[model samples]
Target: MFHHRERRARTPAHETALDCLEAGITAALPKEVVSSTVDLDGKTFAVGDAAYDLDEYDRLLVLGGGKASGGFAAALADRLGSRLDGGAVVTTNVDTAAAGPIDVREGDHPTPTERNVQATAEILERAGSATGETLVLAIVTGGASALWCAPATDLTLSDLQRTTDALLASGASIDEINAVRKHCSAIKGGQLARAAAPATVVTLAISDVVGDDPSVIGSGPTVPDASTFGDALAVLDRYDIRDSVPESVVDRLERGADGELAETPDENDPAVAENEGDWHCLANGRTAIDAARDVARERGYEPLVLSSRLGGEASEVGRVHAGVAAEIAAGGDPVERPAIVLSGGEVTVTVDGDGTGGPNQELALATALELADTGTDAILASVDTDGIDGPTDAAGAIVDRESIPPDESETARRALAENDVYDALDDRSALLRTGYTGTNVNDLRVLVVPAAD
Candidate 1:
């Protein structure tokens, strides 16, 4: 992810899923992916399992947004160099050093801002000017929602702020949030690609969503979308949050969903493809899981990937992971001593009261408290590779038997109540702060159960 930079290997839980996420993240990085992924399955940089020639394209253009968009674009520039024309990209953890010929712009997460609106327009304009020979290389990674923000016309930035805060607090899923995002933006929902008609576009994505659907990752700037404004409204209504959203925002979506506005183009639509744009997923949840599996086996631990499609409340996911740890500590149904349980997926936060922790930190805190087995030693950690989880400063938190507080009593409940697990972990010196890992592979959780009883 860092292009051979010397960031220290953190004392993360030496579990499979975490290892895999780290590796999968490493593998898809522009530097590593271009180098190692060549000739895989007897193909090179193919689309839909068919390798394509890289030399035929006149100039490679990099344009995309997400948490890792900057890093991926930089890596592509390094490998493809003078072959790359210029383009635009947005990310949360953009490396200033890697900001090459591409326009690197930063934006907010979980919420859209005025700055995002400005940057997004530039992206659309750049895409609009592409040619038939243009090889548009898109780098889509996690944290694209906040990084690639563009609220609807009728709504103000204030509306986006409130609606986003409400939706996030309402416990909505990532899919639901993105559904709303696709409808409200000009650049998202394939508009960015629509602007680049007649250009040969190649989208290189790192999937942070549960399913690696092109339309869902960073709102599918190049891919056709199937969701409608009505679907987005249903999400809001289902959460009993219709009134909470801005009036103008609701009206626009209502109009769009009612068929008054054209739905996002489908691949079968005549307007696209001849638009000559194609997208490929460079990395995803499965990629992270695979990486962890290899590392677990090498470490002499029986590795198990719980699941990469984890969602719902962050605390609930933690409970489930904790249950697995308990079973292993007690009866050992799945595996015996020295086991690693790793999971990769974007978890949701159902904001009820108030909490200062993101899903990852919440997951770590919840898991630490749940696994109260006496005869077992397990080190559990949860982290977002992009360095920001929800609205917190630390990437995530770590919890081991030794790391647990002597009086983990009062603070745990209060932490959940106030959404301040980050502060709690901060007090305990268990917060994992990596600044930025230079890549976004979504959330990673590591549960390490050592054989030493």
Candidate 2:
């Protein structure tokens, strides 16, 4: 039997899956990951194998924004207390109180509002004004693309707003969205590092993007970017987004892409070629997936990591994962019965209608309906690391066959069609609300396939 109802009470298997996902997200944001990856061992900030003596640096200034910004910043404040003078960071929902020198600024997310812009500006200014004697520590995490929105000189906020909406609706990948963002922003794609030149800039980052490309995470304000306006235009054209986007956005792209366009710096760009600041990736998909594996092991379930960098449309991804779970229960291609399947990485939704949802919730609903057979029990939970997903209050959804109503297949299809996965799951109490976990290791998904009785 493939489809069976599950009790609402937390099963041993359920609790174990949750704990593993939580541990993975938590482990990815700790100081050990940050300090080690960024090469900020003790006082020395290493670039490649060479370490720079930072004894001359007077104060450590922490700055940046993201979903995991607050958690990562808090860890840094605790670990590097006293050395940190005063720096600002913004996150969706995090307890940010600096007992010492760190200054925490709470802000909105998922979309760039005026308030989020204001709070993030203070961080950018503080980092930009760093003296040669100061160590400007940039704690970057996911959701930073929306949390930290500062448009470039050529692009106005209104222009950016319109463009961002179009891109999100177009179901473009994060990399595609960020290509336009790097061109539109004043503090992305190494521009922030360029602004903080002559000072030591240490970027402590968490990778939410596939392949852990620094330039794609939070648009990589501290990392050198290889993408260009032309690249962005290609994306717009690929998604037929040119006509839908704002007029100014098109003008800027045309101006910037043509040889008349001020070119995005080439690989041998003078800014990075001359400046000496460094970047590091603290954690990523592996961190969360690995945690899920350990949790599955402890719970006496065989753990199968499907893939850490899962991608494509949110609902489509769910169907594929559902197919995999079914395989484990029936075919057992990778592992046998009583297995827990885990995956990490971001999934996106195309806003086809005015629906409230996130990728994870869409994933859950799709999986639930697809696996609605009998005799077997399956549970799928997908949640965003930062908490909020899409326009909904919940990050994502969790559902077994029992969670769905009798009209589930039709309802699920409708919700998926309108990009309203969160609401569809909301009625069933399937939405998982953590209200911001303080860290953004991207998206974590757990697919449980119980052993046949």
Candidate 3:
């Protein structure tokens, strides 16, 4: 829920955008998604179309790490109750009282820390201890790439941290960045599944990636990796951050690519092949977008879902969306007046300056400028579904023509140029802050356009 709903809902249009966002995030909550997707009847355990006989397994262990893993673990813990044999999961945010019996540990996000390494080691240890009769439930979600940190041999936590920074600043896509990360770590790229080999490893995931690719979600700890070490090296080369990244990272990726080190398990690998069918994506960007669309229709607005797989530089994407709004306001080609345009996906921001703001914030800022320049009458709101955008505490931002008034247009443009949209939005009280929403299905944006008087 929004922290100060009244203050942010400045107009009826703004209120509609907020309502859609809330509904979309609420639909993907782990508690809500898990209860509907997973069920237990006596010894029978069901997830999606697959059902397992719990009595057949000697032990049931839960292991995972991510932004949403805590909530997911808690929900599962409530379902299994005494049947759970106890396990651990690392998260950036967690409600201790709601965690039931699962050991919920805190970790850093967007960057790996010593605490993350320690917590992840415990998870690997528990996963490695699984026997043939053990049934392992892995909760993989957004942010696990950092939460489940376990450096490969000869790599240090600092090495990973530096690499993470370089990759993030390089404007690499999540898939590309994760390809590099998977090779530099021991627990990613199907390695967790390897550690829990022979045991039935069932992965319950909340997809935050563009296409819901299992291998890319949480770096595919439980699924087979389609990328190779060569792919990682190529990503670094593509970004031209090879020299900027830690030498140790380059060495590890190079060694793996040269076959001096074993590659991440592919589809043929037994670690993943055995229980490959057990990977389940409980919710995704489409799930959020559709839920938001339903809310838009309920508000008497014709909703047009742009795409759930949108990608590219954030500011450029914002310009495209602004163009669509201008067209709809003029000719109403895509949809008639009084329409709500929606899109959900992860967008990248190429940080060229030492400015603060996430992709969603940058996008909203750019949209405001474009809308004002073209005299388009519309209101746009964007937020990371997880309730945290970039490194800032704000969820994202909201903008309209007045967001960047004529007198303040120069200041707003300067902010976007410096990648500091967070401050600019804050100046206008346009920043959308909602602590931690306990769910992540990528970024969600809603644009509301009203009919001409």
Tens digits of lDDT, candidate 2, 118-232: 8868877887688778778777788888878887776777787788888988989999999998888888877777777767777767878889887888887776788988998
TM-score of each: 0.88, 0.91, 0.98
Evaluate residue 451 in candidate 1 and report its C-alpha lDDT on the 0 to 100 scale: 72
Task: Indicate whether candidate 1 or candidate 2 has the larger lDDT.
Answer: 2
The residue-by-residue lDDT of candidate 3 on 293-317, one tens digit each, is: 9999999999999998899999999
Worst 10 residues of 2 by lDDT: 1-10
Q: Count backbone clashes in candidate 2.
A: 6
Higher-lDDT candidate of 2 and 3: 3
Q: Of the candidates shown, which would achieve the greatest TM-score relative to the real structure? A: 3
Q: lDDT of all the models against the reference?
A: 0.71, 0.75, 0.92
- Candidate that beats the other on TM-score, 1 or 3, i.e. the better one: 3
TM-score of 1: 0.88
Question: Candidate 1 residues 183-229, lDDT tens each?
Answer: 87766777777777777667777778888877778877777778888
Clashing pairs in 3: none
**Any idea what lDDT model 2 has?**
0.75
lDDT of 1: 0.71
What does the lDDT read for residue 258 in candidate 2?
Answer: 82
Shift of residue 82 alpha carbon in model 1, Å? 2.1
